[model samples]
Target: MFFIMTISNRKKQYIETVEKNITKITQYTIFNRTFRHNDRKFHKFLVEPDLNVLVVGIGNGDLLASLNPAVGVGIDISQKMVEFAAKKYQSLNFIHHDIDNKIDILKHPIVGKQKFDVVILSDQIGLCDDIQKTFENIQALCHSNTRLIISYYTKHWEWLLKLAEAVGLKVKQPEQNLLSTTDIEKIAELSGFEVIRKEYRQFIPFPLLGLDIVFNKFFGTLPGFRRLCLRTYVVARPHQTHEKKPYSATVVIPCRNEKGNIESAIKRLPQFCDNIEIIYVEGHSKDGTWEEVLRVKEAYPDLNIKAFQQTGKGKADAVHLAFSKATGDVFMILDADLTVPPEQLPKFYQVISSGQGDFVNGTRLIYPMEDQAMRFLNFLANKTFSWLFSYLLSQRFTDTLCGTKVFLGSDYKRIMKQREFFGDFDPFGDFELIFGASKLNMKVVEVPIRYQARSYGETQISRFRHGVILLRMVVHAYKKLKFSV
Candidate 1:
């Protein structure tokens, strides 16, 4: 009975706080404006354009409205906040429901029998009487593919927030539990959700002469300073237990001046799946590589093979062309130079088909390479950049330059749509997919592969020139992914 009474009192306090601060909450001051705007941009990045989204503790409904979801529903404990939000954004549906009272969210008819693509619990988890129970309630509203995004303030800012409230610079709130990112992840785990990505932002919440962007983008993302940030965002999805069925595969081999390996690329490949299509995207080669691709397609009439000539230069263009024409459930990239063996393609296919990962990347650094597989400087650069990218994306990546990558065709379409966020910067096509996968919050898993020396063609890579371009891409990615708005 005492526990029930305590929960009732907490609910009363939250309602009272919202009734008192409804007007003040909507009227954003410079500090609150900057903070909320920054948050909106981050959430916008986390959410795709046209998804069904549910926002818990949907305060004034500003965040939900910003996402441009196909269908948006918001639930809050405060009736006044709900009414105000409904009146403000009549297009979005808002409901007055107490999440702390162990209410099943699916019981509501408006949201009944409907699963969201993204379920957001923003800044309200700390206020819940039982965080575990709150996540359990939310579990009913999620499908396997649904992404749960939670945002909360770091506990280290408790005193500062109290000071701000004392000075009337911030809205006062009821006393609540302060949870760290780890605490939230563990709590969500108990409810059968696994965190896929985590991020820290806003070292300085207010814009102080443009230094906010500089510090938040560069300094706030660094190792020591990131933990001190004001906000933490976590993206999670429902843990999968069921096994996935096999998916047909498309291997896109982009060849340039590799006439000798055209036919072998087909013969050496293992029949990894029931249905496999091989596409030879031949760039303008002087050694009759295009003719060899045609000859190989004719020679291997038993195999499902197609050939295309690149209308534009660079590997990125060739990849985009092949992806456009690809007719398989999953897409795989194989370098024509065959540094990464064709026999290992099944490992890549198995990882994606079994739902072990969303983006399967091949890592040459994991296993010992054959002699002269990669230059010493190239090897050093790959190691250096892998660590840097892992830090940048908040996901582990061992070899960013690996020629073999696999992902579902459906996800590749979404990544292509999200490619405009980073623009056309990657000439090699690896970073394009890597950055896109990270942006889309896809689970990236690396498969170890033994690197072999190229027997037919010379390496088309220039370490100095490409290394400089890669550095530029890092800076570009930082601005897009870390420092925005």
Candidate 2:
């Protein structure tokens, strides 16, 4: 039919256009140099050494090689580009195909039928004829835990880019789709993907040494400044199906001079799983908190309880010791003061067991707190730290100081293995788990909980002293997580 022929002709024309522009751009060194720099920036966020990566627009194969994924697969519409990539990087598999069209991705022998851990669309979404269909096609290559990373230029930079092209600093290209961050998000939603985080970066594309570091690393992450950045990135994943199986849990209570609340905590904690293991890591309490823990363990003979006296000084050390002794599929941290209710533990457990998120953090900022639950200055500090950490980690977190955090036992072990990177700096054990979960590319979900006034002895935290410690950790995280890559 004529309609079928017209559709075939359009496909041929689109492919020809892409191939011609791609082949032409190969001759420009300045253009390629700029792209190489952009590739490195994307590499820092998308690629981890242990992941399996599938890059949709693998132009020169530099991005794929930079990632160093265990299993790397690259695909492109241009046969010339595919040939160049295949010959240059003999280790990685390069295929000549149009991602806009639906194809059996499992047909490839090298990639096999297994789903990839990360699926990347590196500045190529703009060239697709049907962006939603393009995203839908790649669903076959993803698992529930897979992260889809998309990077593209903001429309605000369109004029500047054209000027660069006019001056021969950049390569000329055919007109492509110009999509804003919100537009791309909507397309992704229609394609069965949910956006987890959105970030803007690269205020200065040219390397200017100290100036570059200050602008991109420090000032670029700021609120109003980040909106003007050249590049925008969205991290998304497939909508997961909830699992209906029961899981065991371990609630770790790192108590340090909370003798009055020990028995109350044990009694009020709800049983949500097949088995609930309670671990008490009593720090060098000036009060008789360790003795109280031992007494409670003997009195509550029906409950699964274990107690340990921490040899180390800080709460982080106590948690590290307790986690080592924990025996459960789900690991959790509950403050002994009972600020966040023990009954809320079931909500955290349900989130992880249902495949909702890998790291579930409790947020106290959403609900109204009890009278005198937190000091005015302390509340202000929590708000300030939340914004700083959300920017630092590229994930939205409202209450970073909340002590109730939960994750799988397997993930906790992996985090402990990489703890040397951050060192023994976190006294509260909050940032250790948060930064670890972010580094592993895990889904982080925040659950709102009521904050109650402490019924025990005086608070152990020194407001000014711990505040200084938190600021130091932020700078340390900036160096290790933001700039190190």
lDDT, candidate 2, at 293:
96
Which regions of candidate 1 deviate over 4 angstroms? Answer: 1-7, 100-104, 207-210
User: Which one wins on TM-score?
Assistant: 1
Error of 2 at 215 (Å): 3.0
Give the Cα error of residue 293 in candidate 1, in Å: 1.8
What does the lDDT read for residue 157 in candidate 1?
95
Candidate 2 Cα errors over 4 Å, as ranges: 1-35, 207-214, 417-423, 481-485
The digit string of per-residue lDDT tens for model 1 on 79-151 reads: 7888899999999999877665544455667676779999999898878878888888777888877899999
Cα lDDT of model 2 by residue, 1-485, tens digit: 00111223445665576566665555537334544675466565555576789998886788888888888899876677788888889998888776765544556665547689898898788787788989998888898888899988899999999998798676665576899999999999999998887877777766675586578776766778988888888889998788745888999999989999999998999878889999999988888899999999999999999999988888888888999999999999999989899989999999999988989999999988899999998999999999999988888899999999999999898777557667767878889889888877778999999999988788778999999999999998888676653
Model 1 residue 132 CA deviation in Å: 2.3
RMSD of each: 2.6, 3.4
Give the lowest summed-lDDT range of ten residues in model 1. 1-10
